[model samples]
Target: ATQGVEENIQEVVGHITEGVCRPLKVRIEQVIVAEPGAVLLYKISNLLKFYHHTISGIFGNSATTLLTTIEEMHLLSKKKYFFNSLSLHASKLMDKVELPPPDLGPSSALNQTLMLLREVLASHDSSVVPLDARQADFVQVLSCVLDPLLQMCTVSASNLGTADMATFMVNSLYMMKTTLALFEFTDRRLEMLQFQIEAHLDTLINEQASYVLTRTGLSYIYNTVQQHKPEQGPLANLPNLDSVALKAAMVQFDRYLSAPDNLLMPQLNFLLSATVK
Candidate 1:
């Protein structure tokens, strides 16, 4: 492979580049322009479907074939500028992601992604030893597949209107749980990438919460609570966290507090408690 792949196989590479990589690039571009939520999810669904079909064509449900291809791709990455370009394209897309929280649920897109991930991981157990070539393949596949998902979360978080944010966050949270649940099924070497996503999701939740709070204005809420004490409106009624924005913010704030993260600074916690009660 160092000398480059066989010229015959290089022709097959051209086929794959034409059929899969080109379509994937178009889908990634779709994601950039698509409206947030269901439309965005639809673009993601198409991208994963294209990827699943491409990989399945090459591997054909055979664990051995899957592993071999991974090794081949990794090696080809070094020798083939086409492979190099593909990897670079994937990495650039990943770099654009920031992170999110949402039930957006086993959405069609989410389901497809998990299905592909599970199929790959299920192809072999982490405990099984592979030759150096196979190990390289595993690394290549893991990086190529999961790296973009973390970024997907970022895109989802960034694009949503607050109205959809909390529910979406909840779904995203469960998606994280599903991702971690599959870790035991993959090679231990892949654990680091898996863990990075877990950590990134935690940060996503925090960022989502922060945005919600900022939108609702914690200082304003706190002052409002102070000036319009429930006691002042006793008997007839009580001052309430009645603003829809405040309620929405509370939902996200409570979510961050509950999800695993160090996002909530103590001062904000103090301000939140004072504002609510």
Candidate 2:
């Protein structure tokens, strides 16, 4: 019955070349698409090839641009993850897709880069390439791209409050995990860089975890105090949390958790709840 429409669709073999006229062949499959506002679904025989194309595109043929875009993406992801807990459409898909080892693209720049490297290693491009040469390029790319992102994330990790630290940690963790792959290069400088990032991650995690727990607990207490006593007086005999300080602290909490940091709660709480949950 649907044969007529099926005939209009496409399924076929495809071929291509790159990095010195090397031929790469692929099998294309039936594509389903919608128009205006639409969704696309495909079952492809060469998903890895598609990933190859995506990586090439994301790189934009320039290392500098790739670095900028990656940092921006990670920052945005961090803000979204920490501030907003809502499950977006893309996240739902991520939940369903099984990523290979290193499981990149949890919205970190390094994650995406590692994923691309994985695909590159599998692709025909890697067939004729020398691992040593490729490894050298990898080190340069990491130094140029990964280093600055780490610096910025480190500053944020150290300077930001509990909520922002949470954002930074999630981002840094993904970056560090992917970055460790660069250890494939055994240069002393690269090794030192790796150790530094590792230490940063460890220190950042401990500090931020402590920060979040303390703040969350305080939030609980504040909510309880406000709920029990909304009057303009000392609710708990805690001088630091007297009316003015309580109001200030509540404001700060809400501000920190606003917008993308909505991971904590959908909205601000007027009463300090009995718990940080």
Candidate 3:
């Protein structure tokens, strides 16, 4: 079973990178080649088909997959009936996981963001003809997917308890910074975009630090004081009233906050700012 699982994962990764990446590279090359307009159109169509197929494989029976497939083929009226059938499958999948709570960890959010980035990048890279327009559309779609994921990461960072959470939070922020840099490359006078990206990064850092200090560290202090003065009031019911946990949490928080700001943010910001001008 383990071997089978490993093989399945490898297959999935291979399908994504090859089915998606190679075609994109080829399409980019095609754009450089001075081909007939009809030939270029055919190539673009083929690239879109490959993208849809690869995405369909990944999503399996999920509702998102159906919607994605429909959007992918929407321009081709001949595929409308097929897309409708896929939409039905997606609706059925949605019924199973309706009203699922927001995913509250770095891994879940990060993985989703990465997958979306890969898909958008693949599509953008594979297109023939007007590069700038395709790039702009790609950037907009990426921003739409990333904004919510970033918000979720901020919320998750506050409640998490493990060192892994901190690492994941940092990684997610870095990914956002990288993506925003790509956007800024497309336009220089996008001051509003620059401000938004910077603000989001600042919020991410501040929220993470505050959560660590209050919930992780200060909770320990509150707990210790409560335990020592148990007879003082109803506050004794609070968890982590122990002095030991309080001290340890505080120490950990201090250690983390003392580190230099990760360099990736500043570098990405610079890149974006330069591109905009």
Candidate 4:
């Protein structure tokens, strides 16, 4: 009689636990499906983490069903948060056919994307995701969000002149690099962005040098020297390129130097980096 009563009591407790957990599971599912934005997802995950520990301690083995459900929802929210943010950014970046402006500033697409990234990073900043997991999270965010934005910026500048294109890309990339630098766990990304900025700066420098040489009427002599390598006889032996022409080019260059405002490409005036300018 005693053994039978004990088994009956256990069965009743199991049913009661199931009945309570059923409604909770439904509510959690509803919350996960109804919410939008990464911030809400992070909040939900944090809530679940609290409940996970509390329920584990209070109910012990009896709350296995509830614990498993909570864990599943936690993982689901994290996965959705990352992928949804990626989809949101990718779609918004190319929503229209906006082009790079005449002043070589950052394109409209880049500005919008940066705003979105700021929101996402703010949410990430306040999140309670564990330390061990953050590195992986940062890598995923970098690949999913930053990479596509950079690609879009590149594509948008394809039709511009060489100097204009480089200036636009540099402006767009510099803004992105600065934005990322405001947050932690972005060192690798910063280094990558720095490399791109340097490459474009090199292009801008070359373009500016060529423009200066052409404006001052020294390109012909410069091209001649390039074609006739040092392996050829002394530069004095080169035909039609001489000291008189060189002197005339130098005077033109000096005149422009005196009025330095007109020397650089008008487009380069909009370069974001002051040092580069």
The model with the greatest TM-score is: 4
How many steric clashes does model 1 contain? 12
User: Which segments of model 2 are wrong by more than 4 Å?
Assistant: 1-114, 117-127, 151-159, 162-167, 170-174, 179-183, 186-194, 201-277
The 10-residue segment of model 2 with minimum total lDDT is 34-43
lDDT tens per residue, model 2, 63-155: 333333333333332233311221232233333333221211133433544454344333322332346644654454345444544444454
- Winner by lDDT: 4
Per-prediction TM-score, please?
Answer: 0.34, 0.29, 0.33, 0.81
lDDT tens readout by residue for model 1, 205-277: 5655555556445545655666775656642243445567567667766775676345543222311112221
lDDT of 2: 0.39
Q: Poorest 10 consecutive residues of model 1 by lDDT? A: 268-277
**Model 3, span 105-125: residue lDDT tens:** 234435554554554455456
In model 3, where is the ten-residue run with the lowest total lDDT?
Answer: 96-105
What ranking of all candidate models by TM-score puts the best one first? 4, 1, 3, 2
Q: Could you give candidate 4's per-residue lDDT for residues 27-142 as a string of tens digits?
A: 87787787566556656775676677787777666667768877777777767763675667686776654688877787777787777677767666665666556567667767
Per-model CA lDDT versus the true structure: 0.46, 0.39, 0.46, 0.78
